[model samples]
Target chain A: MRILVCVKRVPAPGSRINVTPDSLNVDTNHLGFTTSPHEECAVEEAAQIVEQHGGGVTVLTVGPSEAEEQLRYAASVGATAFVLVSNDTGIDWDPQQTADAIIESIAELEADQGQFDLILFGNESADSGGHQVGIRVAVALGRPAVNGIKGIEVGVQGVTARREVDGGYEVYSLEIPAVLGVKEGINLPRYPTMKGRLASKKAEISARETQVAPGAQQRRRLHQPEETVIETEILGTSSDAAPKIVDLLEELGVL
Target chain B: MAGVYVVVEHDQGQLAPSAGEALTAARRLSDHLNEPVIAVVIGEATTEFVSLCEEHGIPKAVSVLDPQIVDYGPELWGQAMAELFSLTEARVVMATGTDRGNEILAQASARAQIPFVANCINAEFSGAWELTRMQWGGSLLEDVTLDTSSLFISYAHHSVEAEPLAAASATQIESIEMNLDPVLCRSLVQDRVTLSEGTTLSTAAVVVSGGRGVGSAEGFASLEALAGLLSGKVGCSRAVTNNGWRSHADQVGQTGTRIAPDIYIACGISGAIQHWVGAMASKNILAINTDPEANMVTKAGYAVIADLHEVVPAIIAEIERRRGNSTST
Candidate 1:
């Protein structure tokens, strides 16, 4: 079965993240870019699915031209094709507009090739975390969609998705032509081999320009959260600290 | 439709704490907009649930009951919410930022063709609603404006404390009938697999988490023993899960469960940005690592510079010794 995976290019955060002086976006001057963690796993999952079944994987992203790095990263892993929905405006698209642009891209691709059996997306973007684009795209496409999925089993008849709930896992069975917003830990994404990287460098990336419209939700600004000053109390060294820990636990009534 | 509404979440005949928190948020919005707070109870909206809402100072409740609504079907629940919104003309709709809460709101927003915001810590209504939403799981904050006829929002999980109002109020329950499309019920939850019971990693009062320094899966047994003594649960970092030392359900990171336990005891974790985002909500953190300069040690409220392998067993032994002495006394 054919599968499609959507990914987002986000700044690679280290120990700390600094926002732009204007509070409009992340200060990428010191940061590199990579695919969001969840989407990276989605690409891996798609590759594994195609390896088991006889099909190909297509990777798509709606970002600036530099986002091709993420698409190429997917290609290096195992994706057969890549689609970049290039937006040169340098402004982030709202969830509604992002979903619309993805829908348009999907329509165009499906027109050339048949509909993909499964579509995958990160549960949410690491940066925006709007948590709406995937579900909105699924609704617009009129397909069954489930988010926060950690496990997926593809069967001849349908697909089984498992979402980790409190104290248990909630399972859902959806037929083909379904969409899933998968979280990280679904799989351990594999590193790109030298040969695969060389192939990815030679791979042709198809680019499409999509017009974006303003949505109801508008960004006002960005700001850092007030940091709570934490005073680290060193109890003791080595095993001697155990007594202090016990005392603190007893004070907290947990002992 | 003009009043603020809170979507109540219930499981196994009891209201989720997130529901209470959502009501608290709704009450704040109600005070700001000068509107009544209404509770929208879906699925098994028993009388007991309505009374729980009343105790929280919600004077009015709308119950949408249907057989297909037994489990969380996003489409069906969203349809019910949309119908309720039209029936009550709710000005603002709020739910807790759990899996179901966010999904149902997404469905409702899509069906109503409106904007839905998730993980909002604060919201103010003055002609247009201004919201402070958590980005990257609270690592960053974004100020946004929602210019919609009707607003849909979910509170950041555990961001607001769930507290009841000072004075209890009488509640009026209104039941509504909804026509749910059969297609919406197609994706209903089919089966549930219970891995562990009692305290879960997210809701546990005390969480003992291990990371790369734990070495292997067998190394976690000691941490588990320590957690058991404290009536807590064992969690792991993304590295442990990636190494197959633990299941993804037990992974604590940006992609895994965001935990807000009363006290989180992190052992061997180096405190990467991904892991810190999930554990930042803990009321207090105690880091046990060999490296004094480890991120976890620097950021934690308390630190013990020691090898967890030795310190953990010592702590466990000390706790058991204390327990035995208390019993003998």
Candidate 2:
């Protein structure tokens, strides 16, 4: 089945993310961006689905033209085409507008390409970390939406998705034309290959107008919180200290 | 009153602590916004769910229950909740920045076609109308003025300290008829299994955790035995879970559940920040490792320099022997 994967550019993990002094938004001047970890996994899953099922795959992003790099990154990993949807500035749009933009961008792509049998996305964006777009877009399209997915399988019958829930994994078997939001641990995303990188640079993409504008909506005054720290020292250890440690854990309520 | 919307999360008749945390934050944010805090609980049943709102100090509780809404389905929830948001026209709708919370807000944002800020740790109003929420994982702050009839945000539950509960009379609760249909929900919970015993490590007061140094799967039984003795929950590092030595639900790290236990006894844990972020909120930490320089040792309240294979058994024996007469605390 054909697939459409939504990718996002986010600050890489392990890097410190700083907010403005007002705390209403991120301080983006210094931070580096990469494919949101979960989105990378989504790309891997889509590639796997296409490889096994013999179908087309399209990587789409609704950000500044710079986000084409993110789609290229997806193409390097195995996506068929990269589509960039932006107006030059990747202004901060809320999750709703972002999803609206995705729906529009997908429609524009489908108008030219064939309809997608499935749409894949990350469970939550590592940078923005809101995790609202995928399911919201699913609602707009009225498709089956699954989040926290750890494993996925597609076959002659249909598509099967598994996600971690309360105790164990919950497996859902649904017909095609569904949206699956991948979690980080689904599978370690593969690095981009040299051949894939070369192909991505030359990939052709069409631009379309999005009804939703990032700045169209209003926001409020942003302020930072006071930093509170409790300084303490680590105590030494000993066989005799086991009792003391127990006492401390009990006080801390661990014992 | 310009109402504050408090969004709560529950699955299979179980409530997540983030829901209460959201209420605690809402109680304060509402006061600051000059509005009343109203709790909105979405579930298939309202009998017990509504009472939980009274505990959160909610004056008005709206319960929308439909069998089709069992799992964390965004469409059904967004349909019911968006209708509520339109009716209440809340100054702001805040849910805990959880997987499900983000999903609902995303759907609500689409339906309302509004803007939403995610992972906001703190926000202060400059006047009757503007909000500035910090981004970049609490590293920097952005200042922006908001202009919308309703504002949507998912407050990172870890950011706000849980507000202390106040003893007061019961609050008024009005149940809203759910206008959603079973056939309308495309996705479903399908199945739900209640944690029979020893779940909820995130909120547990004490956690008896074992890491890679504990050796094999047989070694876990000893840790479980110790956990059972203390009435504490069991937790593991990401490595242990990856090795299939323990369940994923009990894993603690950047990818796993973030825990705020009162006392965290990390046995054989090296104390990486990835692991620390998950349990750094502990009132006191006791990390036992053979290596004196284990990273977690430096942050630990008391670092026991010893082999956990030897130390854990001894500690267990001591607890069993001293059952009644220990003044260590």
Candidate number with greatest DockQ: 1
Model 1 RMSD in Å is 1.8
Candidate 1 chain B lowest-lDDT run of ten: B10-19
Clashes of 1: 4
Model 2 chain B scores worst on lDDT over the 10 consecutive residues at B132-141
Please identify model 2 stretches exceeding 4 Å from their true place.
Answer: A13-33, A62-73, A86-97, A155-158, A169-174, A190-227, A237-243, B43-45, B65-72, B123-144, B158-166, B181-183, B193-196, B208-250, B266-276, B287-329
State each candidate's chain A TM-score: 0.97, 0.85
lDDT of 1 by residue, A1-255 (tens): 899999999998877778888888888998999999899999999999899987999999999999999998998999999999987777688888999999999999999999989999998988888888888888888998888888999997889999877888889999988999888878889999998898799878999988778767888888888987788999877987887899999988876
C-alpha lDDT (0 to 100) for residue A220 of candidate 1: 80
| Clashes per candidate (backbone, < 3 Å) | 4, 29
TM-score of each: 0.96, 0.79
Which parts of model 1 have CA positions greater than 4 angstroms off? B327-329
